[model samples]
Target chain A: MKKRKQRVNSFMVNGLLLFLCLVWTVPTFGLLMTSFRDRDVVSKTGWWTVFTRPDQAELTLDNYEQVLSGKTITLVDSKGNQQTVKGDNLTRAFLNSLTVSIPAVVIPILIASFAAYGFAWMDFPGRKVFFILVVALLVVPLQISLIPLLRDYGRLELTGTFLAIWLAHTGFGLPLSVYLMYNYISQLPRSIIESAIIDGCSHFGVFWKLILPLSVPAIASLAIFQFLWVWNDLLVALVFIGSKPGVEVLTQRLLYLIGSRGQDWHLLCAGAFISMALPLMVFISLQRYFVRGLLAGSVKG
Target chain B: MAGVRLEKIEKTYPNGFKAVHGIDLDIRDGEFMVLVGPSGCAKSTTLRMVAGLEEISGGKVLIGDRLVNDVEPKDRDIAMVFQNYALYPHMTVYKNMSWVLKLKKKPADEIDRRVRQAADILGLTDMLDRKPKQLSGGQMQRVAVGRAIVRSPKVFLFDEPLSNLDAKLRVQMRVEISRLHTKLKNTMIYVTHDQVEAMTMGDRICVMELGRIKQVDTPTNLYRYPANTFVAGFIGSPSMNIVSARLNFDGDTCYVDSQNLHLRIPDDIGKKVRQYDGKAIYFGIRPEHIHARETNPEAADNFFNMEVSVVENMGNEVYLYFTPGNSQYIARIDPDIPVRSGDSHEMWLDTNYIHLFDGETKENLIYKPKTQ
Candidate 1:
């Protein structure tokens, strides 16, 4: 009876997990199939129809080709006025996203790792109080701070530049980054750190030679999270960079592609997949580190 | 190698708890000193102070005549092996051993030579390419020792390094560490809770309790003449059995009288303890000193008959547990003796090996052995 109950429990758990997986992947699968279909067919039938009606599976690259080619887009405003907005090329927007996200990811992690090591290992006055202050910042919603930050950026005359967006992302990302890195780094055995000190390693030597290399799994996982966050972010870029033609990121470009009517679903699907390509590759390549990093400090070796 | 001198060292936390109370110790050059005590005795705290890992709240710490209280651990030229081994999991054995040399900017070939030499000494050459997680507990322990040996520092501090190993492995590593001390000839300060380790390994042992040093002496001297009741009971395996007794003098003979048993004190020990006549005192006797009456009738001075409560046969010998009056006593006797539970047997106490301690203070009253 016990064995039968266990089997039933396991079966129920597996079924629930499979249902969640399908609920998540089915929409993305539809979007992928829609992105490859001809524009007229995408509007005429649901994406699932391509599996049954083989005629609708006539794949075309015209949506992607037109989106990447860069042309003038006609947008209608709320008052029914037509405005021509020149669409930024997909390739340039992709490069701009890289310019913003890479540093935004790298700079915060670099600063947070140092802050985390100090918070975790070094003894100093007000260490606990300072750490608590940093953690408290985690609860402050970024939405509430955006207007004030944009005002400060305007005062500094740094609006609509890569530096402004990079700095904004870094500021928003630092608290949680430090908190996470501290949790992982502090769990390391104290004797190992002390042994390094006795082994003639100065503080910087210990940080550079020992702590950083040992933290690769954590750093890689943090990189994936930050990269995906900054890449998919539209509000921060739209507020800071203001949808300027040359400085617009992939998300801003995708928003421009949708315009006011939301009639360009086929182009939107193609542009969405294009923007997602890099983050998807990154997550796939570093999935192992992600799992390991989450479990690292929870158990002893 | 240099000696370490801790003069009136004290450690008081910010919250006003004193962990080590004014400890004064001198570890000589090329000597093995073991600081031993039960838990919460501050042995590890003292070792850390010497390693520059803990801040000294009061007094001075000197390494080779240079005051090092303010020096960082990296500049103190000391190596320590923690109880958990603390080998770097990310680095191979070779890298773990050579990282210090690399930090010092030594030539690559020199680093290789020193690492290989230390690894060879520890018999870790075959596994130098493996990481710490790939190694067994004993292997990780050896790598920790090897990492310390590679630096060849002035002093080696070990904080219960063998406590994590299995019982059989602990014994094997104990001999290996003693051999390492002989080969290195460096001043070593080891802290452990096990008195057997202290006895077999230390050139001089410092027994502590409640953050105060109880006694400091050689192993044999500690066994023969413990300065206080705590050391006497702590150092021996079966522990010295202490019971309340009274010392009485009759003409020239001295006798110790308990509630149910009366024992004559040998002349040599009686003379030293005779000043406490008619006074309540604590009498201590080791298990081995008590013999079965049938086997050693000639050595019997204080004879008693008691019902045996339990009998443990230890192959070559037997342990007879019994209650003589209100006090329980264990006697290590011949296994051939037909002693069983509920059976009355005659037992002899060899009075020569007995110890007398002050009833109030528990200090040894009969003898004060000189420490080496």
Candidate 2:
């Protein structure tokens, strides 16, 4: 009787997980199918109908080609608003997103790891007070600072450059990054740090060689969260970089696609997937460290 | 190599809790000194203070006649092995051993040479490329030791380094560490709560209790002449049995008189113990000192009837537990005697190996301080 009950329990758990996965994955699958069909067909028929009427479904790579090759497509909105926005430059936007994200992730990790080391191990006056202040900054909303920061950028004459966005993201991303990194770095065995110190390693050497290498799981997980946030962020980039040509990110370009061509499901679906490609690859590659980092400090050897 | 001296060294936390009292010790050059006690005895704290890992709240610490109270751990020229064997989880055994030398900017060839030599000594050449996670517990312990030995520092500090291993491995590593001490001859201070490790490994053992030094003596001397009740109870396995008794005199013969036990004190020591006549005292004897009368009937000066409550059998020996007076006692006897629970037997007390402690102060009445 006990074995039978356990079997039924496991079956229910598996059935629930399978149902949830299908619910989550079906929309992305539908978007993928709609991206390949003709725009007229996507509007007339549901994407699920392709499986029923395979012969009637019109699949093409033209949407991806046009999105990537810089072809201009004009669309008319409701109430006859005609906007002739260019359909190309996503490749350029991808590069701009990289330029914004690489430094945003790298800069904060470097600074936060140092801050975490000092807060965790080094002895100084007001150390506890300073660490509490950093942790307290996590509750402050970043949205409230955008307008004030933008005005500061205006006075500094740095409104249109990628530097402004990088700095904004770094400032906004630091508190969480420092808190997460401190949770990990402080949980490290105190004896390991003391052992290194006795091994003739100065504090800087210990941080550079020992602590940094041991903290790879934490850094990897933090990098993923920050990278995906900056890559997919529309508000921060729109506020700081301002949709300027050659500096606009993927999210800005995707927004422009929606604003100008409200009915072009083919173009919108293809563009959304293009913006998601890098983040998907990143999450998949670092999935191991992500799980380990999340479970750290809660479990012990 | 250099001798370490602690002059009234003390540790007090910011919360005003004293972990270590002001204690003095002198570790001579190339001596293996083991600081031992039960948990919360602050033996590890005292060792850390000498290594500069812990700040000494008061007094001075000197390494080889140089004041090191303000020096950093690395500048003090000492290496420490932690209880958990804090080998870097990321580095290979080779890197873990060579890291200190590299940090000191030693030449590449010299670093390689030293690491290889230490690895060879530890039989870790085969494991040089493996991370700590891939090694067994004993192997990781050897790497921790190898990490210390490559530095060739002036002194070595070990904080319960073998407590993490299995029982068999603990005994093996205890012998190996003792052999390493003999081979290197560096001034070493080791801290452990295991008396077996202290007795087998230390050139001289310092027994501690309640943040104070109870006794410091050789293994034989510590067993034969423990300075107080605490050391007498702590240093032996199946610890020495101590019970409340009274000293009384019938003419010239002095006897330790209790509710169920009456044993005479030897004449040579009776003169000293006679001072405590008519006063409450503590009567202490070890397990091995209590024997079965059949084993050696020739030297049975003090014998008593005890009903055995529990019997633990070993292949070579046996342990018999019984309550003869107010306190329970354990006797280590020959397995050939065939003793069982619920059976009453005549047990012999070797009065020559007994101790008498003052009831109020707990200091052994017959303790004679070593002049050295």
Candidate 3:
């Protein structure tokens, strides 16, 4: 039953944590480094060399200029019409990622919070059976949902659109979001809910006035989880939205940087960091809600 | 305000555990009734049934003659204060106190007014903006009461609301609840496993055990004349000491023998017990009635010799634990007099205050105390 106090001598524990920190930092570190390094210097030397080569300015305003500059990235469609991608190339893609990910993250969370509140508190017939089925969907791989969801909407002529990808992510994200939220919410004090009922609160009153306010922590943490999942997701987007020609996403743009230019990996790195801005900020800010605020109402004085 | 009536109320859980055997009690409008018992006694279940929280299995529950077994809790016109206080942690004290009014769609100004009034009553006006997490246990409890009072529901149900408070606060709130009863004058049913709360706050206390009403009476009556052996022991502090005795009557004289003690019954008991001359009975007395007295030849009615076992001084009063010829008893005596362990002190029984029960039925054979 003893826990050995970890020391610097215990290299494995410290090393794993150090290694994870390094793993986490290296990419963002690379993106930050690549954003500043000159085009030729970035291609020829690893980002680690900026430390040894004191003569080279790894950081510059020109990389920033080229990245921020509005340039047309063109794609020839099946009928061979060239469409110009608009805005600051990175700025346009940032908007595209926002359009796709925000709704993808929000639609599921909004729907799931209601579903979770219902699953945890409501007493309609077949509710238990349906809730169990919904949670069971958590074990379902998102890849399994992609084809059927895309094909069903594809028949309605909805494929290759952001709506298709958003709906797909919503469907994919809802199961796990509801499952996570259900666990957090089911632990709320029964007495408070019952007292709410006695206090002239209808079920909706309980949901809106009692549950929604109390569920902030659960909803916040779940938002972070679902937001990050949909934001970082490549497969769902790639299958539905990314493969489209004119409406290329940030990940698609980053992917093309590797294929067409192959040497413009710094631009790709810059593009990836721009896409990650919201989720990273959101996860960092709202992460504390996951610590344990839902228990506050349950174990009152 | 509304009175409550439960007619043939029954509760059978989904798991088929029948918690409440059928119970029927009419709680008067604007009166305070307490459902008191040991844990698992179904007193809480009964209260919940009346509160429209627990679904009844049979018969009817009425609030102001309205059949409410099927009414939604919000529509039932009842407010409940939970044992743990069950405050909404995310809400400020003001919001918690104002929730019911807000739910009722009361005007902002009115909700504010009523909440402030409740806060003033509970001495929590300064704590209105704090969440339940930041407040002390007593403060949170006041907010709960505040929530209930804001609704001004036709009835109030308290499920061991004071049990979560400290001993001192529990006693203080006990008095406060009684005062609140007079101020608000709504039908209130309280549930607790603590007998003292039942005795102090209830106008009519229902003492329950194992899903059945053991006894229902006023506190004074329950103390002076418990209906059965269970109530006899359950209602009192330090409990009523009971000893089995064999009754014997010889012409005009009567005696009861309990192995070691052969005591002559008083003329009143000595008269009633005359018919059951050869029957077995229980002899009971409250600790306060047993007194230490100077032996006098003429004071035949009150004298007995005690083999003192332990003397406990609780500052103001001394508790004498002694065996009088084999019957173990406690005597709450004046502390100014010195008594020690292993000393034989002459003690007196206020014989008129003793109780007798039939050993088989456990029913009180004594006449009831006069109504206050």
**lDDT comparison, 2 vs 3, better candidate:** 2
Candidate that scores best on TM-score:
2
Clashing pairs in 1: none
RMSD in angstroms between candidate 1 and the native structure over all alpha carbons: 3.4
Instruction: Indicate the docking level reached by candidate 2.
Output: acceptable
lDDT by residue (tens digit), candidate 1, B64-105: 999999999988889999888877777888998898888888
How much of the real interface does each model capture, measured as fnat? 0.47, 0.50, 0.72
Chain A only: give the TM-score of model 3: 0.82
Candidate lDDT (C-alpha), each? 0.89, 0.89, 0.80
Instruction: Tell me each candidate's TM-score.
Output: 0.93, 0.95, 0.87
Query: Candidate 2 vs. truth: CA RMSD?
Result: 3.0
- Tens digits of lDDT, candidate 3, B88-192: 877788888887887788999999889888888888999998878888777777788888998888999899998888899889888888888888888999998
In model 1, which regions exceed 4 Å deviation? Answer: A1-9, A71-87, A291-301, B298-301, B323-327, B341-344
Give the worst 10-residue stretch by lDDT in candidate 3 chain B.
B294-303
Tell me what TM-score chain A of model 2 achieves: 0.91
- Once superposed on the true structure, which residue ranges of model 2 sit more than 4 Å away at CA? A1-12, A74-87, A291-301, B296-301, B324-326
Report model 2's interface C-alpha RMSD after superposition on the true interface residues. 4.5
